[model samples]
Target: MNKALFLGLALSLLPIGCRTSNPSTTTSTGRITTGQRNQQAQPFAKGADIGWLPQMEASGYVFYNDQGVRQDCFQILKDHGINTIRLRTWVNPSSDSISGHCSKDETVAMAVRARKWGMRVMIDFHYSDSWADPGKQKKPAAWEGHDFPKLLTDVYEYTFEVMTALKAKGVTPEWVQVGNETPGGMIYPEGSTANWAQLAQLINKGYDAIKAVSPQSKVILHLDQGNNRERFRTWFDNARSHGAHYDVIGLSYYPYWLPGNPDYQLSIDDLARNMNELVERYGKEVMVVEVGGEDTKPQNTYDMLVAVQRRVKAVPNNKGLGVIYWEPEGARSWSKYPLSAWGNDGKPTKALDAFLAE
Candidate 1:
C-alpha cells in the first residue's frame, strides 16, 4: 500500500495491445503487464503466519529453548519466512486455582517482536480461559453473571484496556479478532445469544471498543469447525442478518475434529468445497486462522497440512488468504502446567513443516 507499490502496480498495467508491429512484446523490464502478470503474480501475500505462547514458566513441559530462552523462537520463525504473528488474550483467565500463559502483557511483547522483525500481528481475543471453539464456548469468569448491559460494558472495557496497553507499547496490531472461534457465539447469555440481534450488539460492543483505540486495525470474527457449511451459514447469516459489524471472517479447520457422514477423505474435500462456497456466499476475505495436521505421527509429524493449504489456496476469488498453525512448534517444556497446550516431547514437532509448505 505504499507509493512504490502503487507505481509498480500501475506501470505493470500498461497495455501493449496488438504489439503495434514491435520487434518484441516484453516490457523494458521484460516483465508481463499487470493483467498478464496477475495470473501468476498472486499479489496478495501468501504463507502461514506464526505465533507462540511463552514457555509456561515452570508449568510442566521442557521447551526447546536456546540457552534456556523463549524470544529466540521468534528469530527462528522469521528465518523460516513467517511474516505474521497471531497472539491470543484471555480475560481473568487464571488465578491460584489456575495460571494463563497468554496474558495481555504477553500479547504486547509478542506483537512487538513480530512488528520489530517486520511481521504483521493478529491479536486474538479468546474472551475465555482456555481454547474457545465450537464444541466449548465458556464464559469468562469476569462476566460470570453480569446482566446483558453490564456484560456489554465489560467487553468494551477489556477490549479498550488491551488495545490501549498495546498501543502504549508501540505494538499496534494489523488485525484484531474480536473473539476467538466464537462459532456458537461470544460472552454467554448477553454476548453469546443465538439471536442475531443480540450477537450483533455483543460483537459491536467489542468492535466499538477496538475501533475507539485503533480505528485503522481490521476487525475479524472467527469460528471453528471450518468444514461445517451449515454452521458457517447459520453463524454468518445471523451475524449479518443482525447488525454485527466485522471486516474479516476467521476460521479454524481441523479436519480430524469435524466429522462428516460419508468418510474422512470425503469430509476434507467437503470442507474445502464448503469454504469456497462461503467465500463466494459472503464475499469476505477468509483466513484459516488455526490449522495443523497432528504431530503424533512419527513419519513427518504432519503432512496433511500441505494438502489442506493447497485445497484452500486453489479456490477462486482469492478468498483463501493464509493459514496459521496453532502450537505447531509447541514448547514441550511447558506442558507441566495443568492447562499447558502441548505434550512433553523435548522437541519442536513435525507440525512446523506444515507451515513451511512442507
Candidate 2:
C-alpha cells in the first residue's frame, strides 16, 4: 500500500509580538528595574505534544512523577527536562461537542498551562475539522465549497484570529505550523502539492498572518517522511520558487513507517544525514517536530531519542532547534498510539529518561 493509504488505515490518528510598550518601575531598595530587561533566549527546545491531556484528564486519567505521586502532567514533563509543549488546533473539530477537545479555546487553555510552567509553546494548525495528513487534508465544514482564492482568505483569517486570541491571553507561541504533515500539501485538491502555486499561496498567507499578529513568532512548514532528503528538497524548493516564506522546516520521523519502501529505506543515520543536509541546503533551522518509539521496547525509544538529540545538536551554529515526541503521555487506556513512551502503570517508562540524558 502507498504511504498515504497506510496512514489512513492506521485508524485516523489522529504567535507573537506587537511592539508598543515601555513601563519601568523602581524597587523600594533604590534599584531601578527597567521594563526593557534583556531576555535570554531558551537554549534548545525539548518538547512534547500533549494535546490529549485535556481529553485524557476528562476521562479521569492522572499522571504521576517518578516517585509515583500523582501530579500535573505538565509539571511531570518539566521535571523530566521538557522545556516546550506543542498543541494541535483544528479548524472546527467535531469529535466532541466542545469542538473535539482540540478546539482553539481548549488549545489556548493548554498553552496557558504550559506557559505557567515556563514551557514554550508551538501551535499546529490542521486546517481541518479532523485528522489531516499526507493521506487527507479535507477542508473544514464551513469551508467546503470555497474557491481557491476564498480558501486562501479563510486560511489567513483563521490564522490571524487564532494568533490574536492567543495574544489576548498573553500566550504568544514560539512557533506556528501552517499545516500538519503536509507532504502532499493540505486542504485536498485545492491546496495540494500537485498545484504548487495554490499551496504556496496558501502557505504564504499563513506566514503573513502570523507576522501580522505576532512578528516575533517563527512560522514553520511541516511535512512527514523526515528521512527522505529528496522529498524535502523537492517540496521546499518548489515552495520557495512559488514564494512560500517560512523560518523552520519541521519533519515527522517514524523509523518503522519511513523505511517501509524497499527502494527508499533509511536508517537513523540516514535521518541524521538528512537533517544536516537540509540545514546546509536551505540555510534554515530544522526540527524533528514529531517522533516516537515502540511502547514494547522502551530502551529502543530511549536510544532513538538520544540519537536524534545528538544529531540535532550537531548542526552547525545550532540550527537544529530540537526534538518533540508526538504524544508520549498516552499511558494505558487513554490512547491507542503505538509509539507512546508510557507503560501500563500509567506513568512514563525508562524511555522518557532520554530527555534527562541531555
Candidate 3:
C-alpha cells in the first residue's frame, strides 16, 4: 500500500570468492587478507529506505540515542547496523507536506550524504510526482497527455538524468529500482499491466538509462506481497514473456499489511519460499527490498525482523541479496506511519536491533 493512501485510509547483494590475487594469501590467524576481502563481492545488504528522512528533518523531527541524547538520524541507523541507504525519487513532485518533495535534487543530495556516512545506496524511481505503489502509479504531472512513444522518451530521459546527477556527485547507487511496487505496472494506462508490450518498453527504457549511467548498478523490478507465489509468478512470467529487462526481483513483505493483518509466522515461511522460487524461476537475484512491522509492538516487530533477515540469508547460493526496512526512521509522530521502527520518544525501537544479528 502507498504511504500516502494509508494516511488517508487508515495510516499504513552479493557473492563471495572468485579471483583473488593469491588464493593462498591468508593472515597469521588464517583469515583472508584485506585484498581478498576487497576482491570478494559485497555482503548481504542491511538496508533502510529513508526516503522520508529529509522531509522528517525539514518538519523538525529529531532522533535520539538509547540514552536520550540527541543524534544524527544516520548515526542512529548506523549504530543499529544498517549498511545501505535506499532513497526514492519522484518526478516533478509538489512541495506538499507529506506526499511530496522527493525530487531528483533531493535524492542526489541524500545519496551523497549516505555515501559520506559510509553506506551504500539504492535509488528507487517511482516515476510519479508522489507515491507509487500497488494501489496507484500515477504518471508525473509533466507527462500527462503524452503518447506511448513520448512516454518511453520520458522514462528514459528522466531515469538517465537522475542517474547522471548521482554519478556527477560520485555516488553511484549499488541498486536502482526502475519502478516501485509495480505488480500491476507503472506510469498509468500506457504502462499498465493491461498492456504488457507497452509496459515492457517503458521498463526497458528505464533499465537502459540506468545502465548507461552506471553500468554496475543492478536494476530491480519491484512488487508487493512477497508471500504470494502466484502473484509473483504471474507478474514476472508476463515480464519475462514481454522482454522486460531487470537484474533483480524486488519484493515487499509486510505481514502487518496483509489482507488479514496476519501474524508474521503465518507468512514468513511463504515469503522465504517465494524468494527462493523466484530466483530459480527467473534466474535473477531476489531481494526483500521493503519490509516493516507495527511500531507499537516492539517485541513482535523485533522478532519478525529477525525472522525476515534469517529467511533472506537462507536463500540458496546467496542469491538472496538482503532485507531492507522501509522508513525505519520515519517515526510515527512525524509521518503518522504505524509501521516504522522508531519509537514515539524519538528513539529507535528494538526492531532495528535485528540488523545487528548475523
Q: Which stretches in model 1 have alpha-carbon errors above 4 Å? A: 1-52, 57-71, 95-99, 129-131, 259-264, 298-301, 331-345
lDDT of 1 by residue, 72-175 (tens): 55565655455677778877544321234467776677678777877777788877765465545577876787877887788889999999999998876767
| Tens-digit lDDT track of model 3 for 235-332 | 99999898888877899999888888989999999999999999888777789999999999989999998999899888876678888999998777
Candidates' C-alpha lDDT:
0.59, 0.77, 0.83
RMSD of 1: 14.8
Error of 2 at 73 (Å): 0.8
Model 2 Cα lDDT, one tens digit per residue, 169-259: 9998988899999989998888888899999888888888887888667778998878888888899889877878787899888885653
Candidate 1 minimal-lDDT segment of 10 residues: 16-25
Instruction: List candidate 3 segments past 4 Å from native.
Output: 9-41
Q: Each model's TM-score, in the order given?
A: 0.75, 0.87, 0.91
The best candidate by TM-score is: 3
How far residue 298's Cα lies from its native spot in candidate 1, in Å, is 5.8
